[model samples]
Target: MTDKYVIPREKIKQLESLLNERDIDTLLIFSREGSDPILPFLIGEDTIHLGAALFNKNGRHIMLTSKSDEKKYYESGIFSKVKTYNTSMAEVFLKELNEINPGKLALNFSLEDAIGDGLSVGLYMMLEELITKDRLQKIEVSGEEIIRELCSVKTQTEVDCLRRCIQITNDIYDEVFTKVKCGMSEKEIGDLFVEGMKKRDVINGLGKPYDYPIVCIVRAGLAHRSPGDTKTIPGDIVIMDFSVRSEGYVSDIARTAYFLKPGETEPPTDIQHAFHTAYKAITAAINEIGPGKRGYEVDAVGRKVIEDGGFPTVRHSVGHPIGRQCHDSGTALRPLKENQDNRAAERKIQLMETYAIEPTVIQDGGLPCMLVEENVVIREYGAEILSRRQEKLYLITCE
Candidate 1:
């Protein structure tokens, strides 16, 4: 089956209803060079030309774009009307806005004006001239909440794509375990990972917006000693964090492993204990996430387990969503700490959604530090762990 979202009419109808409910006349999705993820998600194409799309409460959809992506845009069958614009997007947008002239307009600008940032200065200035000050002031409001909610619910196609990416990631880690040796430099290990990826065409997704790749390539032995010329000697604490992207859908996975000398079945005792503690935290956090739990509650649950086990809590969120982007924005498993801007901390988990069940435990006394991350999709009762959970820390023994 194709990955394209075939039935978006119903979704658009819901958006139109939302506009009417809020007295919003139009919902504007603006992008320069496809900078806005919302536009692509709503339109179902990962690539797009510089363009702006307008959706009105009357169920009309309009688009402005250059020739670069016009064919793909039309073939997708998402928009009702299309206008090609060469020089000024702001002019085209303002012209359309004037025609709609709704009581209010919704733009996806959250916090420091994300939507406006992508607009050209010429377009923005021209827009300012056409719009009435009062009308602009009263009508302009952040549509981030709406966009977030719309993007949060994963369609079955997206979930299936995620599963494929996660499987590729798991396969890569297995390759790492088999080939990695005690004396290999961290960079060598990282190179091995990159090579493994080329074998499957899983190229690194770095330097691309909303693109997430196998990150933190390799952090080993106290982390300060980054993956460079530093050779990972036996008994050194090591963690390799990586991810894979397939069709714009990304998968995230991290595994901590120990290098044991020949004839050694396991690392020394303290490292083993630390690995258990981290595993405990991982399970605790994953179990806490599901349909009804608020984002903060799940973070707190993970933090508590690590702290109760005599480890300090990490500053980052315990878990983050995986989708079009690796750190896909929306609801998240965040800390209880409140801020006016933090939305993910408050939203509840939803069924059928996927998240990375990651909880980093610090083992100060050891040489082989282990960090564990697993992927899971929220199910009816609890999370369905996607990546094979590390039941015990992996051991890469000496040759």
Candidate 2:
């Protein structure tokens, strides 16, 4: 199929401005079997996964690949120029560097963001040796900020892909809710989700399939645990947190289901209260997001709601940017706690960025944990909720 994604030229221009401002004369992004995340944003294709893209201060770019992958690179029609090497990629790479002779070169490496740290230490050492042998200028710096911005900001095509993936996840949940019984085990319920994704020809956005849909059977603690054989019981609240990957984009969503006790038409008052409080928290947090808003400020809006509702504040962030990865790198809606790394939460939210707002309400005395997660896109005025939100709990009728 022909590629349907493109990094808008305007965005490329902005990236060039950022490189110029940082005094980075050139950037070198190397990928081995699609290891680097930033390569997809620029190349817009998965046909040739092994290659290198070089971008200069002028926003112009070139692609270098082996003879085997050169045809696909030409088919892409995205790169301005393409160079093919027969035997020695090292020789071609060294020749390119000598020709450009950049004063300051940037590579994909970061200490703060894991997504920007794709370059391996072993490869770095090899590159250093080559540069030293050639007696070339070796001013190397990390291109974390540039890669972060490129991956965080969504193009129209990316936004559409995310929307489709979210809709698929919603549909799967809607179908699973109708089939789930009061006696079903958590693992059984997770199997239904796996079948749904397979039927729809989609895959889990992150992590392995065994734990992708973190199924909680009336259990409370950390949110990343795997689903177990615990069977669903009456008066229990089950939380299903999952993500879907499609077209190289991801959507994260979570919903809670409450099982009705025998002869009971609805859940207990305490359960109802916890569910509403979590829903309210996520709603308020999403409303607080917009262009130029700080991440911590938005997090406080949701955190306060949970506190006022007589529940313990969640240990994790209220929300985080979602895109190429489930927890994509960018500004995060989190508190600036003392002696903690809160730099991601201190930055201002950018326009066209997407986030997953999840507010958790943990009850004391072994009561069920309530959590509601929703996806949103940062707009010029405010945030737009992309998922068909879980307005109320999914109540299960029991015999």
Candidate 3:
């Protein structure tokens, strides 16, 4: 099945409804040289380069583009009504805004969510300079909440894309884990993942290509650091967190494995304890996920499992939204710690939303670090796990 994207009409209707509820007359998704991340969601297929899509609550949706990008927009056929600008984007934007004459205009900007904050300051300054004071007053509000709501729920196509990408990631993990040995360096194993991506015609999902598939052997740190020359040894636990990008969607999964010494049938005691605790944490988190549940509530349930199991409480949240970007914006499953913004986690989880539930445990005194990340989509009843569930720690017996 193909993973090409097409924004469904229902999403447009949903956005319009949100705008109406907020008394927003129009939402301007503006970008320069196709720099804004929100542009792709409004204009389907990730093809449009430079343009502005004005979604008005009155069902009068229109797109504006420079003459250079006009052809690209038209060719995609995603937007039916397209307007063109001759030279100055700022001047043309003002003209179009004047014509639309919305009483309350919303721009894509946010202080909390990075993905929703795609409109750069430079662009905002240019827009501010061109528009009249009266017009500027109408543009007071940020459309970030609307954008987040629009992106949080996955359409069938988006869910399918994520599923396919996740399957490929799982297959690559299966292939690479089978070849891991007790003497191989962490970098060597990471290179195998790189090779797997190349063979599959996919790219790394989250950060710099080399930094991902985080290979943490034994007591190494659990940050997004690059793989190092630390060699795997017998009785050592290795944790790998990795993701792949395909069709503008990404998949995130982390697995833990233990290299057993000669004649050892399973992982050591401490390793087993940590792994099982993490597994139960993730399972509890998944069970807690459902429509109408709060994100922090879900996080708390998983967090309780780790603490009850006598492991160190993880510094990071239980999980994050995963979509076009690995850490996709909206409704994060995290705790409302002291002095932190709690708005994202406070939002109620909705059906069809996807998240990566990672219940991690980090220890200092000889016990292994464990991060168990699994992708799931919220259904009517509960969250459905997308990846092949890792019920136990993987055992690597090869010398």
Candidate 4:
């Protein structure tokens, strides 16, 4: 089945309306080497270098690229007008801007949010020189609102792609469990997982090859390290954190396994308790997710459970939004302070938002870490777990 999730024209219209409300007469996104993740929003494809997307309040969208990139953008069929340049396109870009005659211009650079700073320091300097001091003075640059809306709200097509990715990821987890063995090395297992995913044409969902099938915490004492040559022995706790991508949509999931010898006792009581606590925390957080809920509120449910269970909370945020990138740009579900106002955070968690809530708990002894992860979508009523296989604990027995 060819995955299809094309954003409706109306969604762009909504974005235009938002720009008007913010008094953003024009939004210009410039990136060299396609380093910015936001490029996918305007170009609809990943093959672009030294390009700029101009969006006006009147809903006019134009893409400018180097002549070498003309064929790639032309094939995408997403842009209405594709401007090509053989030499320095800055002059042509400036002329285009003058024609639009926007009162204010917004660029993706923010000190507060890294997502807003897609423009590298060097690129920003180059842009300043191209526009000159006078035109630069006319432009007002800020990052708060535009980047957030572009990434947070899922377009219908994006939501569908995410949903499918979650389903495929869950299927792979089930298949991997069947091949897991106590004597296998961590690197061997990680390799097998990658091979299996490739058979399905699902590369690392997180957009980077190094992070693909990122089976960290393969054995005890290396909870957050990358998959290595560690051997899996009896009583060893195997933790796998991985995700798969489809058409740039990402789904993240993590699972743990306990290897048991022929005559070994069941998993340690403390380990089981910690695992269950982490599971409870994850489930509670998912239950609390929906429209009109703050990110911190959902995060609190998970953190409190770990704390109450006599274990230290996981160091990272409870969860993050997953999208075109593994950790998409959006509000994260973390604990809130007593004096902080979370109204804006809550507003961002609208229906169709997808998040990966991986609740982890570290035991006092620090021998092992209990981790569980699932991808879910926010609906009008509640959250839905998209990942298929929900692994509480895998018991690998050696004969």
Candidate 5:
């Protein structure tokens, strides 16, 4: 547990405003403790969802939970009401819902939206049964939109948390490069990073920002290699994707380290070119950042950097906003992809939004994928880099 911080009041107010604008009475969510970003974010403390929590348009909040958790929920100070389910969970939820009797409710009902955004189907089904067909008709699958908007931008408190995490991350990398040698295994290097954070109580998000999937990798070698027991060669590259959170705010950044053979100080010609290209893409993307720039346009700026440089672009978004979790949900700057509904990138970037501008480049003939990631916040006039930008590959030279 970290120092107690105020519940993100501004963010909650923003959600309340959205409710008034959309004519929805409440935003209902269902998730266990620490699993849902919105819950911990608005509550400002780790919250346990015994069943569901409801946020009214007036900014009042109530959590429906079992009697076991009722006491704990009240202590959180985030929710104005803590109602416990006495009978079945559904009965308890129905009683609480009746108390509020919101005219219209916004929920993440669609299968994809629920899966992507997380929803408690048990509570959702309970509401369906109690609200009757007419009342259920008023429920809309706009919770994802509400969730997206509420989490898209960072508050001053949230930003401060991220800055702290980034500082810790940079310092860890500084220690890592000095101690890491050519013979170290990728897994070993990654374990060092993990241990460093663990010692400090900094928790890494095992999954993407929104819990889409958990990919914990410490990539080594220039050949799309996942961190394995394989010993690192003299010329092997180190590109690790790590997301660690401090006080529930996550910092997502990656650095490319270079390990040259004995007496070799300089990186290979091709590797240097590719590394610089990746850095250039990140810079170009930052240059394109500002209030009102669409996520896609910003993404194109970075994508063009690699493509014009005769390299293939990354498969995912160039950069996405980070907070509370890795790949944290909010806004995004992603390429326009066919078939999938990628709406975040189409919207305009806003001020106070912190994002990870990571552009990966793959050289012709499939050299190791060159990746450079930095956490940045978009300001009114420009953007500010939260994480130290990887200007040069981290070099481990045995001179």
Candidate 6:
């Protein structure tokens, strides 16, 4: 069977209905340089360096682009109606808008969601100049509901890409474990990991030249400091956090190893205890994860475990959705409860959502630091761990 991009057509229909329910007659997405990820979802192609996508409640779709990109847009086979313009394209854009004659237009700009903020402040100012203040005044603008629906639901193609991303990430972790040695510099290990990924021909959805692989975190010291020129010494807790991208989908994983010498003392009891506690917390959270549960509730499972075990809770969210972007946009699994902070109000874990269940435990006064991360898809039963190498602790013996 030919692989397909899985955004559900029904979901798109639902989004259209949502716009109508909110009294929005049309949704307008503006972009420059094809820098925005949202444009691909609406227009089906990312070639337009500067363009706008308009979706009307009447089920009509229109895309406007620069004349230079008209040929590419036509060949893309994504947009239905394409309009091209030159230096004076403002007139072309306005003319298209006049055809729609929307009573209410929705623009992708929101304080709550970053995906909706694709239109830069400068671009917004330029757009305001193109249309009269009177015309703008008549349009009602908002973002709360629009962004929520656009990103929350996963299309089949997106889910498939994410699944493949997870498998590739797991394979890379295995490769790293095999090549790791006690004396290798942190950079050497990082370089090897990147090389392994390239050998596999893994390409990110957001292709580079502009985008680069993120070394999520690399620490080799008492405090998990950034990776430096220092060689990996026996008894050091070497932590490496890395990710690989596939078709815009991202997979994140973190692993820590201990180098032990013949005479070196074993890992500190406190440090060992903290690692086990954090691992148990992660497992417990995964057990409790499933459809119909709040994201914060699952987060608390991991947080309370670390606190009760005498370690500081992790500073970041337990996990986030994986999609077109590495930190694909969606709800986060977090520890802070709704009553404790307003941010929790935004943490609602929904079904068919993919997340990274990463739990970190730090010793009192920040002693032996450790972080464990894994990707999982939220299903009816619970979270399905994507990365197969979930070691409680990796013991590396010196050669």
List runs of model 5 lying over 4 Å from the truth.
1-5, 8-10, 30-37, 44-52, 64-66, 83-85, 88-101, 110-116, 139-141, 207-226, 364-368
Name the candidate that leads on TM-score: 3
C-alpha RMSD by candidate, in order? 3.8, 2.7, 2.3, 3.5, 4.0, 3.9
Please identify which of the two predictions, 4 or 6, would achieve the higher TM-score against the true structure.
Answer: 4
TM-score of each: 0.85, 0.91, 0.93, 0.86, 0.85, 0.83
Clashes of each: 5, 0, 0, 2, 5, 8
User: What's the lDDT for all of these models?
Assistant: 0.70, 0.82, 0.82, 0.74, 0.72, 0.68
* Cα lDDT tens digits for candidate 6, 157-188: 66677778878877777777788787877667
- Predicted candidate 1 versus true structure: per-residue lDDT over 255-289, tens digit per residue: 87777877788877877877887788889988788
Q: In model 6, where do residues sit more than 4 Å from their true spots?
A: 1-23, 47-50, 203-226, 263-269, 335-345, 364-366, 389-391
TM-score of 1: 0.85
Error of 6 at 62 (Å): 0.7
- 1-399: candidate 3 lDDT, tens digit per residue: 542335445567778788999999988876776678777666552324457788888777777886666765666455557788676666666677788888788888888887689888887776677785566876668898888888888887789889999999999999998788878888998988988998898899967653447888856655677889988888778889889998878999999888889889987787788888999999999999999999899999999999999987878889988888888876878888788878888889998999999988888755677887899999998989999988888888855
Model 3 clashing residue pairs (backbone): none
Q: Between candidates 4 and 5, which one is better according to TM-score?
A: 4
lDDT string for model 2 (227-275, tens) is 8888888888898998998877889999999999998887889888989
Pairs with backbone N, CA or C atoms under 3 Å apart (clashes), candidate 5: 152-330, 209-326, 209-327, 209-328, 222-368
